[model samples]
Target chain A: MSLHAGQHPSTTAAPDATTGTRDWLIASAAAIVALIALYAVFFDNGSLIAATGSYLHEFAHDGRHLFGAPCH
Target chain B: MSIPVLPLLGRGLTAGGAAGLTAGLFSLLLAEPLMDRAIRLEEARSHEHADSGAAAVQHHEELFSRSTQHFGLVVTSLVFGLALGVLFAIGYALVHRRDPEAAPWPRALLFSGAAFLAVSLLPALRYPANPPGVGDGATVAERQGLWLAAVVIGVLGMVLVWQVYVRLAGRSAPVRQLAAAGTAVAVLAVLFALPGNPDEVPVAATLLWDFRVLSIASHALLWAVFGVVFGALGLRALGRTAAPAPSGAVPAG
Candidate 1:
């Protein structure tokens, strides 16, 4: 038998969950990294709530213009 | 300019910085399944002695997704990392308030946060707060084109070097591994230029907009982590991988 099952791939059990969790761990780690960058940006404003509110506005309203012209 | 403090004591600048660092570092740490699958597909197609550019490009796209995901992972990680640090310390300090001797490490956030700030600031400190895209910015469209060109040249030069290193690496390594470190210094300078001028008020959209003085440390450290991890992981993954078996050993279906 081939290593692959039919076009409908042979699924492995549990490893998928573990892998998903691993990805979650990776995402968790990424979230931390994002915070650190944010902290660096907002250290003068230690008030997290204030800084976050500011960021929300920046992200939602104006990131692409500020970062660069969109790829398109 | 260097961040006042943070990296010296804390794990990272922000929750996100820590997570981004981890993600960047871990992307360095883990194998890229996306890349691996693409390579396998490439091999299978190539073994047929066919020139399937589409397959090759599709593989490239897969690699790019992994690469961009790796970048996003870095971004999200940094966001979470800082949050966690603040939360952790506050929680610790509160729980152990009765015992002043255990104040939790106050210095941690400063050091990590400073490091993260340094990363962004050092690169962009010299750059004008308002530049290029912003209104009444220093560079008009034509002038910005020149600066952007210079930046591209400098970056592309480094990227070429990185490409060599990656090729020496296993096929599974992701792209943009070079982009972070390569563009770090220049990006900082340019971003700085964008915001200082009042005309560039809209420039706020481009930046994190939290606009804290400390961002300098976070950005610098973020890339520092990126370069170091990419170097380490690329090497390790290559070392462990077994070369594919010689052709004709396994017949195709």
Candidate 2:
């Protein structure tokens, strides 16, 4: 038997269009969630969570500094 | 083998939570005291300015007490880690798609290392973390914009170098490595061209340096733990799904 043959039996089948689409969707969703979280943690200056007051800013304040986010 | 994305994502979240908790606890013990000192110093400076009639200092009461904010720090770290974990999973899935034969553990660790470099280290080098009293309030927005620009550039540079490395796979290993390094150096030269922080360091050198050091240490811990935990988790997950190799096909460790 060839060395490369059946090496990845479970994943040997070619990925279909559905699998590609699903992967793309998952990646896009993950990217969106990551961006929102990054904003809340690093860049929010009382704007994103203003409705809750400066609570989010204050809460993430220490983390902002520690993680080297621009904070004053 | 092509692993499912969801399972990898789950592992990423779990590993990220663990890494975040570790980093949170570390900051709580080590970085918090330094922050307290910086805040006090800031308050003192404001009072001095007020006394001299240099500027009107508004003494707005903190909505949450210091202790409350301290508690929130851990929560923030945890959330940040979770978010990073999600991104990590997505990144791994994308790279793995292109190179399924690479070992999971090394790939995960290398990925996290690259992230730390792009997200934390490069930005910090360009715009070091300042304590509470250090930066000018008026320039905070500009400084933030600059920092974000640095991070974006660093990440893009990393991606570009990775593409270069991948493209040179058919070449000799040394040639491939050299091309990657040259690409990285070219990227760093671009990063060097970004504008500097607008705020000047008015604080004492010792305090500023110490605080910056501790801040970086905390970040380093977070990434280090993240890499280790993510690698272990990914390896185990891969092991579970990996098929038995045909005789003589299994590569020796």
Candidate 3:
């Protein structure tokens, strides 16, 4: 069936609570992961990535500088 | 029916990633080589300084070769593009939430331009791009602090301008024009008030100018392409779902 034809039923149908919860949970997880990656790319100078010993620093070197983040 | 948010976000991501690739190609071809040359000149200058009895800058291990760095540049650009695209979609949805009569293409383009100003241009005015090996090592933290502060202030200032613009949107054209001018002046005043970080790298003026120009050009390309591509895709997605109102429809009270 065409999307236009089915639009009425879909629009009128109530969203599933469980599905909504699952979507929200997945989105939250993805967001958290994204935030961590952001920190690593933009802010993790040394303290967070101490175990790696500057690998992250060197990897995101150009980006950090491009964004005007301090990397000397 | 109301426009769905998730599909719009997904479309934005796809468009954004494609735009990123295009922008990345431009950077790799035009800007990366210039950056590489700047790095070489910086290395030579550092060596001369060492011979003149100054302490040599410490060299880090080569995590990747020059070619790899170039390739990595493309990947990084794509990732950033994807992130930026998603954020743009979210902002677009929020902006159009109550307006049922809004068109997608123009709205997307406007938002993209505003985003470019907020994210790239504003902070850049305070601390413009510098090639690698240009900044002082000791002042990295201080420079970063100042840069982040400028970005935060710039974004907040734009938000204020947007609010003012929306409020004045219903007024007469003259009033709207005055409001726009007022907002621009206010934002410019704040931006000018921010301290400009002085360049510390011992690079030549010509090289510095070239690098800065290329960097700005790359960003401009990225944003312009993003706006165009996202606008196109967003219009398609929203248009597909938008049902036309019936002709001569009576109000169903």
Candidate 4:
């Protein structure tokens, strides 16, 4: 979205505005999740190799079945 | 006999691309839209006493920026995701004559930097702006989003380490924090030994311990943090202007 130079999503994120500790918990959770996501995306994990196994397995034997499943 | 390694390399390449694409798409579907909404909400409410016309136009601009930024994130993830692994593989092959899993910090950082370049740069972004909009209360969204992206990008580490981060923040006990950290590392080791399935362990199950723990929940979390850090550092690199850049024109300062 069109934002000012100094303003961005990270800089501008807000709480749910509800009264409770919910905002704090969500903010804290979001923080934790985002960090690991960065790790998975950029880091060299054995999981990619695992993903490869699944990808190939699905692509070769299960694409026909799995393809429709996601759609359905 | 001739190309024994080619097929292996091919599999790795395909896997990397698939992982990157899936991650990028997930960002688009889940993370991008949230940020898009924030940008609209921010810009629409920017004026002191503006009419609906200003808000509508601002919303459109926000949309345009979000649409492009969404795609930019996808593409950047693909390039960075694949390159990240490849760069280290090559570097490790040269230096230690093998993979560089031994140095965890360097491994995390090396690829994180890869994202810092492609995802962080404005021109590489398909969005009108490199960083997405921050409207009223946008900073809060920015912080949540950027950190979420980091968690998502980091995946296992986020789920594993964040309990420690939060617990330590809340409890403020060093020994307990160390105990938590050790438990996380142990769990990670067990997971690795099991092999395959990045999303195999349900974050929900993990969240049985804590609710807010998805590594890649929001695209903006990482970017927002970058914006805050960069904005502070960039203040000196730039001259200050009291006013927001005017409509239908770029910022002069």
Candidate 5:
């Protein structure tokens, strides 16, 4: 698949603007989503979703402990 | 020639997934039992506290039986592994972009090790995980904030270190090493200087100690496996494929 770096014919050419932009967009989106999920797991507890009443807390309980997120 | 982006990302993701599965299995086999023990200890302590004429407060209803919880745990680990693998692959692509001539295995190992430190170990040192029944329920928000802050700082500190290393790349090895070490020391100093979040747990000292040790050990194992496995897999991928040549260059054959 020519997946190794410097393996493609374009190596000598400047980085393709389109490809770079697309990759950047994808990476940024994924990071943002991951950060939101992180927030829910580490900080949300029941405060952000008070209607859920500890459901999020309980759902993330083991994970919180596993990832070193402090929860009593 | 530059590598094709998609295939590189795909291989990285595949390798990461495989490593994650192995790490997850290890967690299930080794870490779960220790956690369960801590849970049991807390249960007994709570029962005794309730018996002392205090109002008994059931935290939450168990949604599944013990066996189910165990099964769910394995499933959770697998999903977590998959997600982490994808992230690792993305990171590899970025690093590979920067240093195209670097050998894959060594580069992967370096990247993974850096990630383990920036994302896991450094942050954990500041806000170590506590087993169930540790800490105050009322301060959950504050504790969470401190933990997140540590993670953010660790990541930024690592980025700063990487920048310093890159800037010093042309210098003598000793000079570069000294620079990196100095930057690292400064980062650690700031990280430790931050205010701490000490928790009050009702559990016995031995139980708490055991839980914390197991917690750290499990994560360490996961990261170590991730680095080795990904390094090997990336090396294989690199070996199997040759770089594309510029147009008009005759094929070596």
Candidate 6:
């Protein structure tokens, strides 16, 4: 489908701009979340998930190694 | 065109989740045995030193047993996959926005391939994965910092290449390809310029090589599954959306 197909003619430009901004916002949010998740899975070494008492550390130990995350 | 964000994100999550599960299973079946062997080797080495010295060997108890850790490995893979899926969806949306004329599958695959190269393959070349007992505990933080730097540089390099490719849109195909290749070479130069991993491999050469190879294989499987699955889903979504909507009907919000 064409990007502008369903837009009302009068409001087309406004919606186009709004959609661009919205897409950026969503992408930015997704990026942030992905980074946090990456840290948890790949780099967490009992510092972030200390409340779990290194449980997360041990659990993801193999994954950390498998994924080439810095692990000792 | 102008794909809805939610559906795109949903597909990414699903694809990533599936990819992660497959990778997790792959690692469990193949990599786990190697890891167990490494851990045992590490223990034996430590014991030998202890036997020769006056100091007694202190056993560090595992909080989670091998079985539980195996379970955790799968779960962690799932979570990792889901995270990647979200990122993949974002990438798809951006690509679709810029090049709406391309078929969904090709675009998805291309993006996935680039992602694998930038995120997994390049970084691994610099600081290959080490199995348990291979890396020194003291240098972990520094090693991690360097690895993160490599990932960031790799990603930035990809962005630079994409920008150059996009900007040279009207140029001859060969010229454009050359520019891309040139940019990649430059990126590699920067990557190699970065400091190397501080810790040395303590294990036997064969074991270290096998572990590194398997580590890379698992990542490759993850990306391969993600690309194929996400592309298939993109094709399906496109088919569903290609049908004409009722005249003047507002687009589904």
Best candidate, DockQ = 2
Which of candidates 2 and 5 is the stronger one according to lDDT?
A: 2
Give lDDT per model, in order.
0.35, 0.78, 0.68, 0.34, 0.66, 0.79
TM-score of chain B of 1: 0.25
What residue runs in model 5 are displaced by over 4 Å at the alpha carbon? Answer: A1-15, A40-43, A46-56, B1-5, B99-102, B243-253
Fnat scores for every prediction: 0.03, 0.58, 0.25, 0.00, 0.27, 0.66
Model 1, A2-35: lDDT tens digits are 3333422112212255564554444456456545
Off by over 4 Å in 4: A1-72, B1-13, B48-65, B91-131, B135-215, B218-253
- Error (Å) of candidate 5 at residue A66 is 2.3
Clashing pairs in 6: none
Write the candidate numbers in order of decreasing DockQ. 2, 6, 3, 5, 1, 4
Candidate 5 is scored at a TM of 0.81
- Report the TM-score of chain B alone for all candidates: 0.25, 0.89, 0.87, 0.35, 0.84, 0.90
Ranking by TM-score: 2, 6, 3, 5, 4, 1
CAPRI grade, predicted model 3: acceptable
Candidate with maximal TM-score: 2
Report the first chain's TM-score for all candidates: 0.41, 0.77, 0.74, 0.37, 0.67, 0.70
Model 6 chain A TM-score equals 0.70
Least accurate 10 contiguous residues by lDDT in model 3 chain B: B244-253
Model 2 spans with C-alpha error above 4 angstroms: A1-8, A11-16, B1-3, B56-61, B99-102, B172-174, B243-253
As a whole number from 0 to 100, the lDDT of residue A24 in candidate 3 is: 43
The digit string of per-residue lDDT tens for model 2 on B79-117 reads: 888888888788777667654434666777788889999
lDDT of 2 at B77: 87
Name the top lDDT candidate.
Answer: 6
lDDT (10s digit) by residue, model 3, range B102-213:
4556766777788888878878877788887777767767777777787777777778777876688679988877887798788878777876675566778887787777
What are the per-model DockQ values? Answer: 0.03, 0.51, 0.34, 0.02, 0.32, 0.47
Single out the weakest 10-residue window by summed lDDT for candidate 2 chain B: B244-253
For each candidate, give its TM-score against the true structure: 0.25, 0.88, 0.84, 0.30, 0.81, 0.86
